[model samples]
Target chain A: MTTVEKIKPLVLIVDDNSTNIDLLVNTLKKDYRLGVAKNGQKALDYTEKHLPDLILLDIMMPGMNGYEVCGRLKTATRTKDIPVIFITAMTETAHKTRAFEAGALDYITKPFHTAEVKARVKTHLSLKKAREHEIYIASKIQKTLLLGQPPRDINGIQIAQLTIPSQKVDGDFYDFFKINNQCFDLVVGDVMGKGIPAALLGAAIKSHFLRVLNELIRLTDKKEFPDPEKIISSVHSSMIDQLEDIETFVTLCYARFDMAKYLLSFVDCGHMRTIHFHADSNRCSLLRGVNMPLGFPEQEPFKQTLVSFQPGDLFVFYSDGLTEAKNQDGVLYGEKRLVDFVQKNAIMESKELINIIRKDVVAFSQSDIFDDDLTCVLVGIEKKSTSQALSDKAKLEIKNDLTELARVRDFVRNFCEGIPGFPLDNNRINLIELAVTEVTANIIKHAYGEHTGERIQINALLLDDKIVLQFYDWGKAFDPKSVPLPVFDGSQSGGFGLHIISHTVDEVVYSRDKKGRNCASLEIKL
Target chain B: MKLSTEKIGEVTVVTVLTEVLDASNAEEFKTATAPILKESNKVVFEISQIKFMDSSGCGTLLSFLRQLKSSNGNLKLCRVQEPVRILFELVRIDRIIEIFDTKEEAIKSFKMGI
Candidate 1:
């Protein structure tokens, strides 16, 4: 009548001998709650109804022997861990071995001593408790280790990552952190192998990255930034030294970006490709450079490449897991599929892009569990609108009037006012004004002198760090490249205007419009 | 950032102090440490400070160490940081280079030198 929690460990006794069952019940009742069954079938029924921590079976019971009952109990996962001990009159070693082989934890004699019965039961239960405790601790450790929170959004870039391990943990890790107002560093890597060993190595790599980044931050704060190449190389060496004992390595890609400069530099350590999408041109370029994977015994030099990115451009970096994911029919998802998915989902925000890829990969594999860990990061450069370029009222339309020089001067002043932190030196400012005047005068004197009906449009785009001045005119096409090198013979007056325009700007590009008109574009880096 | 040293038979084991060295100032460090190279052809650089290093720094260290090798003495590195250690592995610097993690171990390595 004791409560379930207070009741002693339950012992089930199955025997055909009424006297033996009664004796066992009386002997163990002080230390345990005892259940009796006359046959193996009844014993199984009793076990299914009221689970016991231990079982004592009589081998020679009629209609289903102890061996069959023990086998059935062990096969059922719910009752499998319950300790079974056989009671037999057979004194042969082989018979005892058979009883032990039949999933019994121990064997007791037919006329068991009360103390002997209690000792065997207590020993097996303690061992079982210890095993269960070990399993519980292992599960707790695994849960704590595998738990990961998604990356937070900074500026317009949103990052989310998943590392679905084939075992308790995976070897993939990623990091996204800001270096400055216009610079951010991103890294992702996969250690060779999987599971606990690789995961531990992965954690080591993560720690190294954090340490290096902290050093970088300190150096930056101190205004004595170290060369990024050296930092990465040192990180590689440290990782190699740490992982040397494991006979494994890591493949990493490190990239740093300057949003203000619109430049990105990256180094690849035998990682997969990094994709660059030019939003304005709708073109995609893949960066494929190789260095030895970390931990190799050779010192492969790391190379850093710089790329210019405009607003609305996208940079996508991913681990091979995405391209290597296999479909149900054993067809790999492949690089082409990944590229296509990105292209189709390019307009989506970074978070949405990741979800789309994840959904597609899951649907393609036809399984919720991925064969390999999946990780993807997309960095989107938000485009500034034309209104943000410069004020509409500040825009000037060049007219055919002969006395519009004052209007042009007013336009320059307003244009400069519209741009924040304009760093125009006196010489450059004068040069720009002279170039504008010469170009406009040339169009007026040569192309539109007699034709007042023709209209010319000039637009100025104020970018994140530079200003682009574009001149569009319905005038006849003229190729500047075809323009003869003007012989500037010590300040010749008329012909040097075009020469001045070419030298005064950073870059000048000319293209013919579809209507056979002329368009001249100039870029000035700030 | 950790500093520890060991001595073996007039050879001084100096542990390196930094995680990564690059083109920015690696050449200067090489220049400053040249006196140690001159003092003993049998110098063991315990490179525990460097976690990462680039090719320029690696090249500088290799060229200096190789100079020591030509004098029938040797320059050794020990306890290489992992990332910088990777550069040595990629270039197979370990094959020709003697590296150890402990000063006692690296000093012991010098006993069999040519």
Candidate 2:
């Protein structure tokens, strides 16, 4: 038996004559699985229930003749592709033409040759098998290409992603890698098209990112870190050269965060905006104005923008799949909606933030079928230390010197910069400076008697979105709690200094430093 | 966007165009001309009397060439004025999208398409 026969093609034979059915059955049963129908109606019923690879029809069938049966079978989409061969007594060319027109693949005279029947059936069946096999392999490859590994935890950033392919595969991808002890990089991108071609291109681009990251790390370790702009520029050129198809381009965002410096630098290659939230101020901002997508050889040097982070601040990076996700009404879950969601849920913990956004996207789209891959990376800056609060009298000695005040301001700025969700706006900066001035001046006038020989030390620490500023000084002890709650008459100026500091900040506490000197500490949401 | 093109030969096609070439209208132009660029290597964009070319307009053209190059196809520009040329030059886009002198020369070079 040939390879085609080994697969056991099923053939349905319809003939009114018992002798003819037996003859055809005997001829085909050895090579194919056979189903016999005595009439055209029976043949149609059998074909509808069990779709066979081919059909052999006897032209002289009783009710519903072979020509009518063939025409009906040929008209139905499900049965049309099944090759039919006519076995009839009529040998006229016009009769053969009518058979062919009715979608018969071949015609055999009443005295049929077993070999001819076998050859034609074998040829058509094998061709069908090959076509099906090609489609199967193509779909399998597309599936394998899309089943990317989920992001593993790197540093404090929590990443969870879901990808749903609209067709056989998708081209969107997101990856996370720890570049060093103090830094981690997040990458999210989408290739231009869909299916196996775009999947392959996406895989290529992802592999390139890995290779470039490795090289970047090696260079940085060797004190030869190439400029990020140059690295991306070369990658753009190389990708353009390699994937020379206009239907395939990559819109990517590459971000590297240094925990030690509390700084994040990112290069946006014509992607959706990365939303950043200042937890302290309860406000949000977008990182916009990026260059064109990668693989455009003519693209200019792309620059990376740096943003400072304080504890409790959040950075959200996502693909267009999320923003462009459309609801059943065809309205997109646009950038504004995304930003609003992020702002409302920014206070949530990192894992909760991811879950909240994921749920929101599902609700907004109002469907389980996500048209594109949805991926989001949430980075939350955690507080580094917990320090003791100081008393009011100690704050006086700590504020005795100009050098000490400057040192305290520098420390406050640095601390604020490190925390996430803490606004480093000019208003907050000025408030910090003014609060320090008023508190120190009150400490000198009320506790230290303007003594130049005294020394004061103040420390400010970030706790989530709040900044705890502590003042310590070597002076007579004082308690701000006992100090009259300065009544705000709305027009009172001089006495409102302490009141201003209290209301300006989120909270204040009074306690003693380690040396028993009086200290006053205030906590402000930056 | 409307596409009115005059084929210089079997190789090159010169597009004489007018429409809002911004992001809002670029999709139509991109869809209409993308297939033509894929079939041939040489495409000369004649932008001498064009009115406006925003970032999105320029981006559409760049994306076209980028798509062409991905398929081992090439696209070139010709007959652009100093004003429009300055936009490309400003971004140093000349390095990416090649500019030619005339449509005839661009078509002639594709005698053996890439």
Candidate 3:
């Protein structure tokens, strides 16, 4: 077999003097792929097209000095991570400090020694390689830990979540557990440090969640859900030593949603404050408790607080990457802005709400790249209405006046009650009523321009375990896409109508009937 | 909409006496109640009779909240009906304003300066 050739790491050399260039090149050429640039500008131009594994730059050069070149390289995303070593004839300590301040990884003094050059270059190159390997491993571990999928087909809760693993330091995780038909649990965790170590710890914490939970299940009654505090306490005890060794901690928020009891009990451990959207008051509040992040030995025991929620309530659990995101002005996106955004868009479906929130955060920061892991989870409380039986169909008619809204609700209530064995609860019926009222209001306000003497038709397609409501109006045809996602301009206008309708119903489809009437159909799965 | 008012401590507990607080009477209720509660900084809206409410009605409450806030005063609610209460929650207006389960609690909150 023919001998295989090793691919040497590429190195770029920049020097104004050809003699010095020749000296350095002869020393490095034997072990590296060498690229030569006579001036700083030439070196920058070379780096623009080709990325070298290492850069040896001369500080004293005319036309774009090496300090300027190294600064530019460190500022650029593509070249920022490339290791840059400076070469200079000056023996002053100030020059060396300036070189470092300009982001030079290391510097070589004047009058080059071939042995010293070889040793420094070899050591720096190996250090760069080791760092790259660590990042690669860290990212791989983060990806593996993020393999969980949010549970599906929950009766009364809508969950939307996002996770973006970072290149440098990343350790963000979220998981959902189905405790029973009437209850569920959600936990979000983030390791405080960056890079490979933090990522590994995050993975470890995620692995421990199941072990701690299962042990509680085994030791206690199987019929009951594990307590949030007990599970977190056990996880902390097991992971504290490892965390202390690493000098880092994990922020965790564990919440249990009990649908039957209408309670959300949670234990917050040094995580970002969880946002609570109260459906009854049209308000948002930050939820936090007195507990240190995991690994704090002096911390009080984690305590769970219980808060009641009605249908249409919402919650947002996020990592620091979201709230701590910085704009060009260095202003943090901040918790207040997030609360406002959530309050404005509270009527939206959870998936749409979270995706828009992510987009908003990126837009506010003016960049998509994050130095830390970005993660967020949204939860919306909904009505789990059960009907005793199904009906084939139903129909109703109403005037353009807003007074007709009450009549519309009555019609829906009667329709659901008329069905045998229909699961009609206060929460479920409330949602259908709200959706119907919202659409009718939109028709009167936007389509009819709030004029009187207008009439509309309502038809209900009561299928198996679902209801589809259709509304027909002779008013102007409307483009649903024209409406922007909800933002509070302090007005009742904008997309609140569409948001509420979409949030309440499983599906909303708008079409023009054969009779040229505007038809909007909304479906709710039982 | 019909209106009834009572004074418990420094708080004026106003109750809407009608079942419907919709577009038909939202503007009227806002206009009539704003003057009577103008002299007091602490106001409690005990609206249990409002079994049905629309967005305009909710807007009326918010406008009053802003008005009270402008003067360094405050407003609260008590005994809101379920349907109307859920309506406020969906729009998140309850966060801007405080709601109490009882009128006495509302008055007590004003006394406690909460």
Candidate 4:
């Protein structure tokens, strides 16, 4: 616990000879904490409890040889990464090769060279530490750069994403950057390579895209988003020579989402064609482009295409890793199966639908291991156009009494659930139920007074970002402002209903429509 | 409201067998619990069944506490649902009302007399 107690790397020495154990203990004790095992079984039992950083194993013993002991250690997941060096009196090439077959990293033939043993142990320990540190840095970079929090409140857009960066993190990236209040960018890219070089290049290319965006932003108006085409073309022009030098090409799909206009402008550089599903007609279409991958010899200027979407539409952007995923039969999962699945399941919530697709892909592959990053981004059009009505008006007439409050809740539920693509979650539904309850109760008690025979009509108006509930009554018009705020400490009972109505819903207004009917409308935002 | 009362010592535990305690059933709940309140000064409302409660429903519980306090008695609530508890906390009624996670804790509070 204290700084004086410096922790040492643990080394387990497995040798039957007393002289060799003595030499190994003396050489390693100064740098590492040492554990000794006289025989192979003792070594196995000792390792079961204590996980040494490195093991110096002997090749010959009475019951088990060093090769068998090392092989057993390699088989275990817990001790597999621990470096094992065989200590053998037999200097034959066959013996040393056998040690390597048993998973020995290096061998120190006896009449031990103390300096060589020390150097090998130190190098292996540092290598293990460096590997662990690299994984940690990769995870951190992936969390902050590759994966981002998508804007959930953007009206008309519901996005669900799944990206599993492999342990080695081979060059699969997805990123989101907000341009302005009305626009944001979603980009997914894949570096056509593997391991450390590809991962580094992928991270470099991702940040390079950001640099290009910033440079373009300075040259253009601040309010307008940097064009997706300009951004992609710039990245291709800058990186093409370097990529060709390295013999690697990067495929990218750069998409700009205009929140105010409900449009998606994108530039595709030889990436997989994004799938567009029309929930209204149950049809799926692939949106593809003609540009080559970033590093191709024949580079073409990037072309940006704009697409407008309506309610109940879905767009799915994916990696080739998805469609090229091979099962035990060695057949690709392919685009046709994915399209059919999305067409049938596009009407569901984005999270649920994306999860189903992810499960299907994983199942079809029959293994979690993938050659590349398994990634996909699904965008669901959640709201109707601002100028257009979502559907026919939903209205319900009930007796102006406290007992009829349940009917009002059912009307709200049926109205919301009946819409083609309602984006309201359960919590939102519960809040609406409570708000309507308070409003209807106030109407029955104040507006109608003791007139239980009077009937009240409620209309549900669906909008782009919110739903408006209109409660019409012929009784005296109720004034929402006249009712004071409810005392939170329970001192005032009169304003509790009004306080609930005002706080639970987004907006509440009381107005007298033409023929003297009191209309109390509550706007509830999704 | 199906009100079932069980007497533990001088404390009476009444469980309301209903999911909602909003404006629609606030009056029914008050009327149902009235006989139990008359029988026991120390009453613990086991409201695990009451899943939904708005401001009006919360108001009824506060009124019951006032009624009990006037007669030098106290009211406790236990097994409160998550939504109902949120409503009470939102209105700051949790400070005024004695709320506990279990019926035994509520009855113990009654015995503790604080």
Best by lDDT: 3
Give the winner by DockQ. Answer: 4
lDDT of 2 by residue, A1-526 (tens): 1444467788999888888888888888898899999999999999989988889888887789999999988755456667788999999999999999888888889787878877877787777776545444434654565334533533334444444444224577766666554566677777777555666777777777668757676767564445556567667766787766654578888777766567888888888888888878878899864688887767767888888877667888777778887875668899899889889987676777788787888788775456555666667765333111211112222446433544455555555544433346545664565466556656655677757777666666655456677777678777766666533221211354466566456677667767878877887753
In candidate 1 chain A, where is summed lDDT lowest over 10 consecutive residues? A487-496
Tell how far residue A347 is off in model 2, in angstroms: 1.5
Candidate 4's displacement at residue A192, Å, is 5.2
Give the per-residue lDDT digits (tens) of candidate 3, residues A363-417. Answer: 9987776666788999887633332233457899998887788888888877755
For model 4, how does the per-residue alpha-carbon lDDT over B1-114 read when each residue is reduced to its tens digit? 898999999888888898888777888888988887788777888889887777678888888887887778988899987767766766778888878999888988878784
Per-residue lDDT tens digits of candidate 1, residues A286-333? 876667778887876777777888767787887787788776556888
- Which lDDT tens digits does candidate 4 get at residues A1-526? 1211358888899989899899998888898889999999999999978988789998889899888999888755456768898888899999989889989999888786889999999998888777656655665666666665787545456789988665456577888887754467888888887656777788889878889988988898886666888888888888878998999998889888775556889888889989999866789989887778889977767898888766778899988878877776668889999999999888888899989998898899776655457789988877455314636378899998788888898899767654444456556677778889888888888888987689899999876577899999998876767867667665654467766677678998889977879988999876
Model 2 spans with C-alpha error above 4 angstroms: A1-162, A217-227, A245-247, A383-526, B1-114
Q: What is each candidate's fraction of native interface contacts (fnat)?
A: 0.00, 0.00, 0.12, 0.40
Screening candidate 4 with a backbone cut-off below 3 angstroms (N, C-alpha, C), the clashing residue pairs are none
Q: Could you arrange the candidates by TM-score from highest to lowest?
A: 3, 4, 1, 2
Q: Is candidate 3 or candidate 4 better by lDDT?
A: 3
lDDT of each: 0.68, 0.67, 0.81, 0.80
Cα-lDDT of candidate 2: 0.67
Number of clashes recorded per candidate: 33, 33, 21, 0
Local lDDT at A53 for model 3: 81
TM-scores of all candidate predictions against the true structure:
0.43, 0.41, 0.56, 0.47
**Candidate 1 residue lDDT tens string, B1-114:** 333445567686766666545433455667767767777778888777674454345556667766776776777787876555655554456666677877778787777654
Candidate 1 vs candidate 2, lDDT winner: 1
TM-score of 1: 0.43
